[model samples]
Target: MDGKTILPRSEVPEEFTWNLSDIFASDDKWNEELEALKAYPERMAAYAGKLGESAKTLLDWFTLSDEITVRVSKFVQYASCRSDQDVGNSFYQGMRSKAFSTAVALNSAGSFEASEIMAIPDETLARFYAEEPKLETYRRSIDKLRRRKAHILSPECEKILAAAGEISESPDRTFSMFHNADMRYPDVTDAKGEVHTLTDGTFVPMLMSADRTLRENAFKAYYKRAGEFRNTYASTLDAQFKQLKFFADARHYNSTLEASLDVTEVPVEVYTNLIDAVHGNLGKMYRYVELRKKILGVDELHMYDVYTPIVADADVEISFEEAKKTALEALAVLGKDYTDVLEEAFSNRWLDVYENTGKRGGAYCTGNGWPHPYVLLNHKDNLDSMFTLVHEMGHAMHTWHSCKYQPVNTAEYVIFVAEVASTCNEILLMRHLLGKTDDRKQRAYLINHFLDQFKGTLYRQTMFAEFELQMGKMAESGEALTADALSAKYLALNKLYFGDTMISDDEIALEWTRIPHFYYNYYVFQYATSFSAAVAIANRILREGESAVKDYKKFLSGGCSKEPVELLRDMGVDMRTPAPVNDALSLFGELIDELSALLG
Candidate 1:
């Protein structure tokens, strides 16, 4: 497949398609299960107020909830996979909508279960566990719910909140429809006079173009359209923020950030530490920008020029099969078991590979019930794509291990620790590639790639995180989150983060309009923190070999059984302290030095 041409979903080869039938053999079967799931609300409602009856009754309720969870998970996974394959497919779209509605219905009806369990005294719960030994299996989950007792509303209030679940997502849904479905960009002519349609999917690649004129044109053209709908985006964002505040206030949280991080028991200091550490190291970013300007031989560096490859002549083309082998070789440091999981992911058709018409852009690994974790990739045959292959494989393998080792209740890891596994794979892959090659040019290319990761994941994400914090604070403080206010704040942050090395274009201010993560309260900081954690873990694995590998495996398998920070600490990285962040930045400085030497 050519980079310029996207095949339709039906035209893609079967081998590249995920075996979704592993979950349900056919759509009819999916429909059957979906219909059966409708009765789950009634079944779950039957156990309401009965959780405190006895240990046997409590175990029965847990079993029933698990059964509903398994069935609903399968239904939602199948529908989501189908819809993602082609967003325009109405059948799958309806299926996805229905699945969501059913989930909300079940949640609304089952809201009493947690409140009732929370009503049980600690002594009584312990006695119940003693009376029915099987209840001990759910002790951790029960405790987790108990920890939220302070935030738990009355049963009626909980029911009302649960019923409003679908309504709460309106802003996000509206923005998604506007961003993906309605908005369109004009065609921009490249330096060669070839016209290309500017789209969300093609915008990044265009920015990464070596042709400065093309990158600038695409940047302006894409944002110019976004600028047109600035009010719409701002309104959507405003609504989202208001919703966050509503939930926070309703749950008695001091602030929205507190509400967001409280779910995972993450301390606010982790977020603050990332911003402070990155700000302290802004000189490194400024130096990188200076290097970019010097290497590209441009008198003035602009935001649009930031993404182009510094080692343009060293552009590496890696095919899918080649990527698979490279990822396996790189990850073999984790020993045979981890490598075997990667093998299963490839051989078992666990991935839906390649970009096709109407397919979702970007990549992710999603785990549902009992089926193998599924990975979605819009794979382009380039160095970045190869790294993405390994990155997503990292996630797939994490899901595989966690799902294999833990029960349904604790199988899903929290987002705070999720990126560690994926980013760790990426770091390991880069080290493996660098180790395997001594060619100065290739090494320089790899180092440049590594620096880009640091810039994008560590520095850039921290910048976004800071901007998000400010926005949330402003909203909480009654400041209007108008387009002007958001854009001005973002621009100021850009100036502070980039320093004087690059020109901060006014259009770059509109970047907040395009980031969907802003709608996700306090989520982007995890990328920065997770990348730092990965750097520490990967270095340990490379330096200490088997011992480090064992700990890393344990971190992956622990899932949500323990606090995320504690889990990372067990793997020898304490994100609470500034050590990991500083260590990662120090490594960045070393990479820059090596690249400088190689270039000379």
Candidate 2:
């Protein structure tokens, strides 16, 4: 480990950690709940063949199912969050596995529900709804199931699939273990001969270093280490896609993408449309890449150079306290209700701040099931980390709003719109920073930051989206996803997205091995789409003031109560059209112009 010491979980200050006691008072309490939950799956088995018996029977099943869901969710969340806090801890990992097994058993027990519901005639369901007043609460869920009647397999088949759930998670689990727990990155050395610990948490920060040697060395070492295990990574990725294709084909979906999108009610066109929009605007990305090379005073811009600040003087450290204060100030436009919850997040131990030994890399916000929205950050004192603080707080707030407004069944928002609130917060933060600074250098720095967001969130994620699409199709066509094949496709994408200015270093091709998102099953595309939607919404909030803020919050609170596209449409950005993506890229083009002028 370099000069920095990542504290053990036990040594981390109590104030800096999230309070898991909010979910369960202690490990004993969690175990007690686990034992109690084990009996309920058998109870669910009692309702297996009885869903279509009558209105009361169906209503009773829904009540029982929702209760189990909430409890099991809390059970799984606690164990998984604990495990995430320290991936090296076997006790928590065992607990998490048990939780998953319990969930799988419960799923198997309830596997008959969907098919039975689908089997009900339209007229019978309507009659049941009329008979049971409370059944109206699940009308949307019921209707959605009915719509997918074609996809719902026989009850016996569903039971088999349900049983396979835990086993099917093998690829993701394997990769997670490899990336977080098993893989070891070599220590990188700076020009001064000082060594730095290179880890998942430290890799990006090293790339952001002002020292060119350190950046290049860290970049080479990190990817080179990953490249060594390329075949193993490729096998896991192959299994992931194959599993997706298995379920897709089993469910009678024409393609894996179709199956994935169907769950969210998103049209396939939305996915293709995003790529089409980004492809149309490649020139903007190319121009930005060219400008980066010019500003960095480098003849060749390597992959390692991409993250270092083009406006070097503006790169500065931002303490955690400063991050929280600036986040509150920047997000004040979101009104009192949002800020109130945000304030609680800062003070109430809702965040597990700072990196620790064996802690998971990156940042995320989870509710650990309702009433407690938690954020995990490998927090560094820098502008990027400040933006990360606000970004995750956005997710925490969205979880807070959705849970407060929507019922349990519909509270969790789909992946499609999940990134909107987070990215919108980022855009707002950038604008806030830009507006407060009169100094040309500061403004250029902020603009560069915004441009980088466009590059990373918009351009880079779309490239990832493209790679995913190609891989999925290749899998469907029976093409093998070997390490060399994956790396070639990934490198080509890097070249295309970064334009001819980028070196497309061979080390970067191994990047697919490191991405946790590929296992997410077509999840990265939404980052680009969400960034587009956020650009539009952030601009509206800034322009229209209270009315826009009101609508934006409404969208956050809406959850899955309405279709995601409809919810966004209600807020004025329509994902059904290409306008949002085009508008976002237009802003990217304008920002490049703005940054160029400022630099001049």
Candidate 3:
């Protein structure tokens, strides 16, 4: 297909794919930058022993690293997005594969450098900081460095870890490449008797269709196709688990989850406690599902009806341009700095919004620890897509701020805290919309939106967390994670969460086959934690004002300046306590009541 054949952001031609020119102005410029980036890692050999020298040496190195990080990050964003646009685009794919090597080399150097910094005598570091006033700004980053220093393996061991690095990530990368290449869906017939080809782009729209028949056919089409590759998915996922086990053993951690959290200093209990809290409130979720069944008036609610539109003829159709405006308005509370970046994102085209042949499904904002975060969305002009855009931009903004304000070593925050900024954007959008809308249907739509947040982030994610934890435990206890065992666990959890309201059949049982998070090694729980914290943060910002915004920006800019959980606590939301989780669940119940009232 010609590049011009790409789908527009909407039915209109006035829309365009995201603008990357804002970052580099042209591909020629990016090539020049890529060349320069590949050269910087080798330069690190000169700084071998210099990291522990003095505050001035460290500070100078940090500045140098930041500059290099920004440039390399830009190269990465450009290449990755291009590859995503067309997984078959060999030019960009080859370039990205090469870039991956550069990244691995750079990461090796980084791990080595940070490990070396940890070896410095405490007295020497203190003396250097005292002598260099500018270094005082980095107190938190330095403190975190000190904490991680204890976990720092010997330099030789660290080199071994780095050398075998990319192999550990092969499972994920291979799955992504294969799924993009081979995953296919059957054509779905809509209520009007028109047929639409079921690609990832059309799947969600079908699910959200007001026509139950369309949703049912769409779900059947999806799983029937996905089911063909079950054995392959299972094998790839198993390899991913083995990789996790390898790293956990290599790092001297008890398990993959513990090893992963050790990167951000989050306790494993944070995950366990989240699932437990959500489990305690599973009744609320079941009731929500029950309400869905009643509202849809389906005698037997199927998983296909899960995302079916409740309000017949609901008018939640938001255009891309309007969605951009809504995002700007919804995030208006983040102060001038936030709005400024957001404005730049929209106007300057920091996103590629159009879906083309081979374009990856889903949305995310990713940047190396430096440069502005680049976002990719398989653009669909709908309210949910609007939320998706703003949600990702939140991550981009947080990444931009963290990299700008923190040193190279601490610029990357833990994924645990990473979700706070994104989900806060989501909660903010909901609050903004709910405040402005009074129409019962719109309010109901907004209420549905909030409910889905709990469904996806709180309830659904907790279920995923359960699967993750059980698998990890099973992996620890010498149980094999075969396809049947995994599917049984997933289906049973579905039964638990859905209760008597909906059917939990074998088709939905294989739903685990499609989830990429299983490869993530205990990463799903953050969605719940982040939602809890976001509820607290978003509430404070709406109830308070500039104070909350100021606090949030501090949290964003702090990055890995300290332990992420501690930074969130300093900024007002405490993940360690269950208060936020309880508060969030209470809010979910309130939505359930509102929707119940409207439908009744």
Candidate 4:
């Protein structure tokens, strides 16, 4: 917000940047590593038809594979993080492309391992495990692969599929380029006639402004720019879903959802159960929407008005330094051990902390058990950015704990439960802030923020999940996903979810064109599902104290050591049933009642 303009990457202080050097000493070193890695595919391919030759032979391959995995993981993470730091940096862009290509080649070379392993008889494999005790390190991974024996294609077919990995990534990569690098927006002028720069990072903060004219102008302009390229986005999405369908069909799965869920051993029922639970609670959402409209005193509510705080006087700007302190204090409930690691994250520059020219919009956390986890953030001096900080740190801390506790092979957690830790962090921060205040306006403001979490994370994400499913089905039924067809379906979903409380503006229909998650086959549902689980977990942590914290920490360390659902179930939230979602919705209803009483 300094001067209301994004600084160039060179202008940003080094202290505020992430330390990618920890992954590679320099780009020359990275290139050196990259050059060496190009030879691995041939080396790995030489091991074909020999996986079942002996126990030690299998163990040797596993050891070499694990070593290469750690190296490749670091390569990809470093290149991508550098590229994301400034999407317009051509050097890092090419590095990222090469890293991905080498990764695919390596994967294609190892495609024979699965079929070869599955060819080993169950009894023979059990004996092999007994013969080589070190092989026990990979018992879970072996079991998981064997569990999918039916889906294991021939080595040649597996290689073919593996080779398609880069091509399948085209949609997401294209969208990222279009969104972060190529896309441009006109300057937005405020009610005071002050011209403010508009970018992806600024759009939401603009909507949160109290000035209605600014909010409306920003929203319409942003979407109008996106609308111009609607057909291109539609084609990319069509190709994405078709690619997903191709893989699902090849693997003998019934639908894209089944293929996606089966990878992490999640039940298809979990997805359906979320939609059903949210549908049952639509009345609560409608009430919230109605309450928001009443509080704003608007003749008619538009999508642009939805983000502005209903409590006007309580808007407060929080500095990044203050946000760090607040986050530490808020997370203190997790114990000294956890807070110590958090301090490390702050001090060691694990986070790239502000937006710069050509930086990728939004935020993410990525680490692969190398030195430590790294978080990318466009830090703003506002409540939402603080929440984003803690959310991503939640992911970073989860990565830290998992890497420390599990081996490289098992340390990586699946996407299913990835949001739980982050959401729990936000809930804890909300509790800490809410506990610190009792004034009517302040309490109402905090409550409204909490309500927005449910609306955004739980309701909106589920809406997206539903749209993803419907889109997938449309593709499967042989429908062309033209821009008009896609927009109509999206607009209808908006109408269904928002009900009669707000106008289904035409600009909002093009909203789908801007969402990067649509390219990620069925990735948004976890935000909703995990939010429900986090509510239960966060409530228990505060209510039960140390015992709950102990269980939660263990869950964080669990990585993919167990199935994701079982990890949460062991911690006492059963995602397999609707209980968690229903419980969270009940709490949402209660908060609405509280906000109503407080505002009254």
Best by lDDT: 4
Q: Which ten residues in a row have the lowest lDDT in candidate 3?
A: 1-10
Residue 32 local lDDT, model 2? 99
Error in Å for residue 100 of model 2: 0.8
What is the C-alpha RMSD, rounded to one decimal, of candidate 2? 1.5
Off by over 4 Å in 4: 1-4
Candidate 2 structure, TM-score to reference: 0.98
- Residues 133-241 of candidate 3: C-alpha lDDT, one tens digit per residue: 8777666666766676645687778877786777877887778777775677777897888887787667776788788778888888887777787778777877777
Give the TM-score of each candidate.
0.97, 0.98, 0.92, 0.99
Residue-level lDDT tens digits of model 2 in 38-149: 8987788888888988999999998898898789888888988899999989999899899899999999989999999998888888899888899988888888888898
User: Would you list the C-alpha lDDT of every candidate in the order shown?
Assistant: 0.87, 0.90, 0.78, 0.92
lDDT of 1 by residue, 285-355 (tens): 88888888888888999999988888888886688898899898889989998888789879989899887
Runs with alpha carbons beyond 4 Å of true place in candidate 3: 1-15, 25-29, 49-63, 131-139, 368-370
Local accuracy of candidate 4 as per-residue lDDT tens digits, 1-600:
431447898888898899989999899999999889988887887789999999999998998898898899999999999999999999889989999998998999899998999999988999999999999999988988999988889999999999999999998999899899999999998999998888998999999999999999999999999988999889988999999998999988889999989999899999999999999999999999999999999999999998999997798888889899999999999999999999998998888989999999999999575788899999878898999999999999999999999987789999999999999999999999999998999999999999999999999999999999999998888887899999999999899889998888999999898889998789899999999999999999999999999999999999899999999998999999999999999999999999999988
Clashing pairs in 3: 18-351, 18-352, 19-349
lDDT of 2: 0.90
